[model samples]
Target: MSAGDISLVAGTAGAEVVAVAYRSTTHGEVHATVNGGHFALWFPGDELRDGATEGVQLEATFRDGSTATAVLTLT
Candidate 1:
């Protein structure tokens, strides 16, 4: 089993982020979001790779109108 968390800082207003998303190389993508200054995301066993691994990618957009990404790997 694997688990992890991500923290983001929303520097200004209109700062929004997609905190977590799930997808497979074969399938498409699943979208999730969080508002405000910070968020925590978790991925359970089998969610990352059909019981092989667990991980999450977090996407963020700043109020300055810039975008960024952070990745967390769990084991």
Candidate 2:
């Protein structure tokens, strides 16, 4: 597992990031807020990893029934 922080641009209001998962591993819910069309969340330590240096998938769910998917390197 890997522990770290993740950041994204909300791009709009009323968007609350509810969850984040990497691969098949689910990360704990970190309170997310959008200020100036941006917000950040944390994956902490040892909850998001598969020993991959790149191409790790992260899926984020919003409170408005919206979802966003992304990929990045896990350290």
Candidate 3:
């Protein structure tokens, strides 16, 4: 496994970003916030490689109670 990063634009004309989450059964969970623009999340490759050989899920929640999901895989 290797360290990874993901960037996303998580807001709209009316709805805005409420929270962002990175979840992994092996790496645990991380939560963050964005100030209406693009946001990026990074995970340590060394630490993640110890156990994370599976897919990790990323979620973005909006102020409108809407959510988006993305999956990333580490080989």
RMSD of each: 7.8, 6.7, 6.7
Candidate 1, after superposition: displacement of residue 19 in Å? 6.1
Tens-place lDDT digits, model 2, residues 14-37: 337655544434543444454544
Could you tell me how far off, in angstroms, the CA of residue 56 lies in candidate 2 after the best superposition? Answer: 1.2
User: What TM-score would every model get versus the actual structure?
Assistant: 0.37, 0.39, 0.47
Measured by lDDT, the strongest candidate is: 3
Ten-residue segment with the worst summed lDDT in candidate 3? 6-15
lDDT assessment of candidate 2: 0.50
Q: Across residues 1-75, which tens digit of lDDT does each residue of candidate 1 receive?
A: 135533222222233543444453434554444556444433333345422243445455555566676655544
Model 3 lDDT at residue 8: 29
For candidate 3, write residues 11-48 as lDDT tens digits.
Answer: 33223767777774445776655655555555544444
Best-performing candidate as measured by TM-score: 3
Off by over 4 Å in 2: 1-15, 25-52
Stretches of candidate 3 off by over 4 Å are: 1-15, 47-56, 72-75
Task: Give candidate 3's error at residue 48 in angstroms.
Answer: 6.5
Q: How does each model score on lDDT?
A: 0.43, 0.50, 0.56
For model 3, name the residue pairs that clash: 3-45
